[model samples]
Target: MENVVPFKIQIISILATLGFMYFIVRQIIRGKLREEYSIVWFACTIVLLIFSFWRKGLEQISLALGVFYPPSLLFLLAIGAIVTFLVHLSIVNSKLQSQIKDLAHEVAFLKEKQLNESTIK
Candidate 1:
């Protein structure tokens, strides 16, 4: 019975991962999610699905890494993925901020020039 429980859990995990991947792809297809963002999500889901399908491999890795609890490894991977995604977003946000500032300055200068020309005319 105990052996059956672990097998059931593994099956459920794979199904859940598949469902998540489907949701992410659907969002991308609907244009609700950008491809750039979806790429990270897809990679995360794929990694999770791979681990779920290969439970013995995951266990071996955990043992080799000296992690007593194999499930904790999953949490660690999830955290790493989230941190990577956030860093990517932060970098993109910084670039967009600089571009917006430059554009605002250019618009202001152009408006000032037009105002001066009108005043002189």
Candidate 2:
């Protein structure tokens, strides 16, 4: 990207990003993607939206927050995004664990039934 991006290009980027975000939301709503997986992308897009519109605002916010530099905000956001993704994965993992437990129980029950039938024979 140019140091000073043209307004038209910025507008186009913003529109393209918005379109992508809309597509993501549609996919999530349609069950093609889960809420957990969608959050990181949402945060990423929101960051991009902010950057696309008001990158200078980041310096102001950083100054207000007593940060050394503005670009550090990107790193902060990256960490936040990672944490959000990890939380989502944890939730999904818990759901998977429960399902696995249920399946194991079902398998055990079937095996026991089979064993009893074999003993009867």
Residue runs of model 1 more than 4 Å from their true location after superposition: 1-5, 117-121
33-114: candidate 2 lDDT, tens digit per residue: 9787787789789878877797466666777899866667768878887897789789989999999999999999999999
For each of the candidates, the C-alpha root-mean-square deviation to the true structure, in angstroms, is 2.5, 3.9
The regions of model 2 sitting more than 4 angstroms off are 1-16, 36-40, 114-121
Residue pairs in steric clash, candidate 2?
A: none
- Model 2 superposed RMSD (Cα): 3.9
Roughly what TM-score does model 1 have, to 2 decimal places? Answer: 0.80
Residue 30's C-alpha lDDT in candidate 1? 96
TM-scores for candidates 1 onward, in order? 0.80, 0.65
Minimum summed lDDT over a 10-residue window in model 1 is located at 1-10
lDDT tens digits, residue span 31-99, model 1: 999998887788888887887777687777878999987778878988888898889899999999999
Local distance difference test, each candidate: 0.84, 0.82
Error of 1 at 81 (Å): 1.9
- lDDT for residue 15 in candidate 1, whole number 0-100: 91
